[model samples]
Target chain A: MTQVSTTISKEKCFEQLLLGKTVKRVPGQYLSGSEGWLEAVRAEALENARALNFPSDRHDDWRFTDLSPLFQHGFQPVSSFAKLTPGDIEKFLIPGSTRLVFVDGCYDAGLSELGFSGSAGAHGVTVSSLVERIGDVQVETYFARQASFKQDAFAALNTRFFEDGAFVHVTGEAAAPIHILHVATRREAPSAIYPRCLVVMEPDSRATVVEDYAGLEDGVNFSDAVTEVVLKDDAQLQHVRVQRDEKNAFHIGHCSVAVGRGSVYAATSLAFGARVSRHDLHAVQMGEGAEIRLNGLALITGRQIADTHTRIDHAFPRGKSVQLHKCIADGAAHAIFNGKVIVHPGAAGTDSSQSSRNLLLSGKARIDTQPQLEIFNDDVKCKHGATVGQIDADSLFFLRSRGFSEERARNLLSHAFAAEIIIKIPVPSLVESLSRTILDRMSGVRT
Target chain B: MINKDSRVLLEVRNLRAEVVVDGVRGVEILKGVDLTVRAGEVHAIMGVNGSGKSTFSKVLAGHPEYTVTGGTATFEGRDLLALAAEERARAGLFLAFQYPVEIPGVSNSALLRLAYNTLQNERGLEELDPLEFEDLVLEKIKVVEMDASFLDRSVNEGFSGGEKKRNEILQMAVLEPRLAILDETDSGLDIDALRIVANGVNSLLTADNAVVMVTHYQRLLNYIVPDYVHVMDGGRIVRTGGKELALELEARGYDWVRAAA
Candidate 1:
C-alpha cells in the first residue's frame, strides 16, 4: 500500500470549504438577519476569508499542526437540526442556571431555559439570542468588535456564516451563571457547524459564564467557533470554557477578550476530545490596575491532536496577568502549547508570569511547548518557563511503595496533574464532572 | 528486647545485588549480605558511605533499580524477591526513604487514605470512608507531632528537610508494617526533630514487628536504642554485637572495622 501525497494549493482548499459546491445546509430564513449593520461586516469577512491562505506546516505559527486531515473529508453545513429534549442534554444542564442550547449551530428555543421573563433577568442582565436583540445598543456596539478575523481564516469563516449565538449583557450583578451549550449531533454526512458568543460586562458588575461545546455522538464533524468578551471598569467575569467534541471531529475555536480599567477577567479552558483541535485565546489588558488569569488543560490520547495558542498583552501600566497551561498526552497523541506574554513599552509596573507544563505518558506521545515573553519596559517583572517530561519516576515509586498498584499510581499522578487546573472552575458540579472524565481517560493509559 | 523462640520475621542469606552506576550496569552494590531479624527486635546496620547499607535495605524492599543477581530473602517463610514492590509493601515490608519524593498536587491526606485503604483491601479488611479515615489520620498525626495543616497540603512538597523525615514517620505510623527499614532516616534531622522521630518509631514497635535502621551516625541509637548493631564493610557485615558495639564505633572510626574484616 503506497501512501500518496497530494499537494493541493491553498486557494483550491479555500474554494472547496466555502464555495457552494459541496452542500448548502442552512435554510434561507435562518440566514436572513434584521440587523443591516452586520451585512457590511459579513461581506468584509467573506472577502478576508477568501484572500487569506489556509495555513500550512510552513507557516511558523502552524508548524506542528496540520490542516490536511480537515481538508481530506468534505464537510457540508448541518441542514436540519436534531430533535433533542431536555433529558437528552441533562448532563450538560447546570441545575437552576440560565442556559442557551445550540444544536448544530442552530438555536434550540425548546431546550433553552431563561430565568425571569424570557432572556431578561434580575439586576438588568439580559441573556438572549444575538439576532433577537439586534436593535439593542450594547449588542450592536460590542458584537464583532473584539475578535479580529481579518488575519485568521477560521475566525473569518466563522464571522461570515455564523447564524445565531448567545448575547449576554450584565449591568449590576449576575448571581446565577449563564451557560451557552453547543451540542453536536451525529450526522449522516460529515458536517460543519459555527457557534458564536458575545459577552459584555458593565461597570462594577460581576458574572460567571460557562461556554461548553459537547457532542452527543462520536461522529465526524467540524466546529468552528468564535467568542468575544468585553469587560468595563471595575467589572469581574469568571469564564469557564470546555470542549468535549466527538473523537473523530475537528474543532477550531478562537476567543478574544478586552479587559477594561480596574476590572478582572479569569478564564479556565479544558479540552478532552476531538481528533484535531486548536484554540487561540488572546486577552489584552487595556486598562490600568487590571488583573487577568488564564488557565488551560488538555487531556488527550490516541492519535488526537490538541493545540493551544495564547497571548496576554499588558498594554497599560500597573496591570497583572498569570497563566498556567498543562497537557497530558498519551498513546501517539500530540499536544502543542505556545504562550506569549507581551509587556508594552508604556506598561510600566506590570507583573506577569506564564508557565507551560506538559506530561508525556508514552514513548510515542509528543509535546511541543514554548513560553515566549516579549518585554519592552525594564520596570516590569515578567517570568516564563516550559517543561516537557514523563511522570516523575520517584513519585511513581513512592506511590507504589505505599501499596498502590502501578496502574493506579499512574492514574493518580495523571489525575493530579490535570486537577490543578480543574479545581479552579467556579462551578462545583462542572469540576466534579470534569474530574470524572479525566479519570476515565487516564484509566486506559498504559504508562 | 530480643526473644529466643519468637518467629523469624525476616531472613536473608548470601544476598547479592547490583545497581547501575553512571550508565553502566552490573556494578555490584550488595555483595554476600546475610542477616536475621526476629520478632520484636530492632537491629541497626551501621556503615560508611558507599558500603551498600542503603542498597541492602532497597534490595529487601524490591526497588526496581536493583537487580538481585543471586541470593534469597523471605518474609515469614514467603519468597520476598518474587513479589513486586507494592506486593512487598502489602506483605508488611516498608522502607522509609532518605530523600522523600515531593509529589505536588496530591494532598497528603488523599495519599494516606488511599494507601491505607489499599492495604486494608489486601488484608481482606473493610476500607474506611473519607470521614472515618479523617478521624484516624488526625490521631496518627499526633504520633509525629505534625501540624494538621500538613495533611491538606501536597505530599511532601516544599517541606523542610526535618519535616520531610517526620512525614515519612507519619506514613509509617499509618501503614504499621510488620518489618520497617529506615534507610538513613536520621541524616537531616535536628536534635529536637531526632527525638520526636525516635519517639514516634519507638512507640510503633510491638512484639509482632521488627525494625532495621540503616545509619552512619550513632547519635540516633541513643534515642531508639537498638538491641543489636552490625558494622558493614565492603558490602558485607563484618561485625555483629550488642548495642555496646555502636558506642565502640563512635569511639573509633569504621576504619577499625574495615581493618578487622
Candidate 2:
C-alpha cells in the first residue's frame, strides 16, 4: 500500500485563495454579540486553513463527494455585484413575521425588518449581526464554543472569511419566528461567499428560526456557510434551512448545534439547487434529557450532486435523537447521505435512530448512503438504516392501472417518499412551497 | 362474438396482443380473443391459470405492458386501444385489481377524489369540494360495508386482503363507470367479503352500464349472477353459454371444458 500525505501547496490552498480580500464590517448591528469573538476565532482559523489542505475524497468524511471540481477555479473576492434587485429578493420572500435579508454576503438593511419584540415591547428580543455587537465573554463562548474546526477546512475558512453573519437571540421570552434570507447576487468574477448565522435561544424560551438560501441563475458561484445554534435548558427551537441556489453554483454548509438539559432542537433542510452541494450537520446532547431531530430532503438532477452528512452525540443520560434524510437522484445526478449517532458512557436509556432513503429515477442516476451507530453504554436503543433503489415497479403499475398516467404515478410516489421528512417540519406555511420546490427540482420525470 | 343483436357497450374483435419481452420484442399473451358485452349485462370469463384471463382484461383497459398486435376494440363506438389508461378511465371504464398496490402517504380519500374529479371534469359535471366529496365517500362506504376510517388512511397500505377488495368495490361505487371490470377481485376474499363486494357491484349496476368479471371460480357468480359465461382456453373464448356453464365447469373442472372445446 502507498502512503499518501494529505497536504497542498500555498497556491492551491483555500485560505490562500480567499484570504487577500478586504472585508468591511458594519458596526452597531449586532445588539448582543461581540466582534472580538469573531476576530479571536478568525486568527486561529486562518492559521489552521493555511496549514491544511482542502478535504479530498481521501478524507473519510468526503469519501463519496468529490471536491476536485471546486478546487480547479480560483475564486475572487465578492467585490462587485452585477445585479441586485428588490424583485430578485421579493420574488422568493415568504411573507411572514420578522426577517433579515442579506444580499451577496452583505446585510441588506432596506430589505430587512428587525421588529422582533412582544406587542407591548416588554418581551422584546434582539436580532442583530456580529459586525455590530461589542466583544464580551458570554458572546465569545457562544461564538467559538461548539463547532470545533480541528479537522474541518470549510468551517475554518468560514470562521476566517465570513463577510458578516446573522444573529438571533431569544431573551428568555417567546416571540414570533425570525426568518433570515441569504440571497446571492451574480458577481462579476467567479467568487465565493461565506454567510454565517448564530441563533441563541435562552433558557425556557421557544422560537423558530428559518434560514433561506437562494441565488440568481446567472453563472457559477461558490458559497461556504456555517451556522451555530445554542439551546439552553428546556428551550425549544425549530430551525429550517432551505437551499435554492443557481444550478451552476457550488454550496457547502456546516450547522453546529448544542442542546442543553431537557432542551428540544429540530432542524429540517430542503436542498434543491447547486451544481454540487454538501451540507454537514452536527449536534451535541450536552445535558440530560436533551432531544434532537434532524431531517433533510435533497433533489438533484442533471449532473448535479447533493450530499448530506450528520452526526449526533448523545453525551448525557436520557437523551433521544432521531435523524431521517432522503434524496432523489435523476439523470446522471448523484446523492450521498452519511449519518452517525454516538451514545457515550453514562448516556443510559438513550434512544437514537438514523434512516436514509434514496430514490433513483433513471437507470444512470445513483446514490450512496451510509448510516453508522457508535454505542459505548448498554441499556440503550439505537438503530440505523440506509436504502438506495428505484421506485417500486408494482407501485407504479398499480397507479398507472388506475387513472394515473405513468408520469403522474412516478411524481406522486416520489413526492410521497420525500414528504415523509417534509411533513415532519413544524412550520405550516413551508409545506406547500417545499413540496413544489422538490417537484420542480426533480429530474428525469416531468410532472 | 356472442349476442350481436344486443346493444353492445364493448366489442372486441380478433384481439391479438402481447407484452414486451425484456423491454424489447413481443411475447404474445392474448391470441385473437373476441368478446362482446351489451348494456345492462354482466359477463363472467372463466379460465385456468396461465390462460391469459388477466392479460385480456388488462389489454382492454390500455395497460402499457400489453401491446395490441392485431385487434379492434371499441367502447361506446370509440377506439379503446388508442386511448391511454387514464383516458380510458375518464371515458367511464374501470378495472378493479385482484391485488391493489399500497401507495404510502396518499390517503384513500385523496385518491378517490382525484379519480372522481378527473372523471367528473371529463363528463362536464360539477366537481365536488373536499367536504362534499367526503360526504359522498362516507355514503358510498356503506355499499361495501367498509369502516369510515379507511377513507383517511393511506390507500391499501396495511389493509387486509378483504379490506383491499372492499376498497375497490367502494371506488366502483363512487366512480359509477359505464363499464366495470373486476379481475379476480374475489380471489382472496372470504364468503362474507365476497358477498359484500358482490352486493356493492350489484348496487352500482344500471340499465345503461355493463360489467365484466374475470375469475377462475364459480363462487363469485353465486352472489351476483352473470348474464352470460364464457370459457377461455388458450387466450380465446372457445365456448359461450349462460350462467350454468360456470357451475358446470366448476363442478366438472377445466379438463372437461378443454375437452368439450
Give the top-scoring candidate (TM-score): 1
Could you tell me how far off, in angstroms, the CA of residue A235 lies in candidate 1 after the best superposition? 2.2
Residue-wise C-alpha lDDT for candidate 1, range A234-336, written one tens digit per residue = 9999999999998988999999999999999999999998999999999999899889999999999999999999989999999999999999999999999
Clashes of each: 0, 3
lDDT of each: 0.88, 0.81
Q: For residue B10, what is the lDDT in candidate 1?
A: 93
Question: Which candidate's DockQ is highest?
Answer: 1
lDDT of 1 at A103: 90
For model 2, residues A1-447, the per-residue Cα lDDT tens digits are 221223444355464455546444344333232355566677888787766658767788888997766665667667643345667676666666577777767777777777644122235456765555435344566885666566677887877777777877775564666778888766555668888888887788888888988986556667888899999899999899998888878899999999999999999988888889999899999899999999888988899889899899999999999888898888999898888899999899999988888889988888998898999999899988888888887677766656677787788788778877777777677776776676674433222
Q: Candidate 1: where are CA atoms >4 Å away? A: A1-13, A19-32, A117-121, A444-447, B21-26
Model 2: per-residue Cα lDDT over B1-261, one tens digit each: 234466788999999988876677477888889988898898999999988889998888777677899989999999998898888888888989877888776779988887787678788999898999999999999999998999888889899999999998888899898899999999999999899999999988888888999998999999889989988988888888999999999888989878877
True contacts kept of each: 0.62, 0.53
Docking class of 1: medium
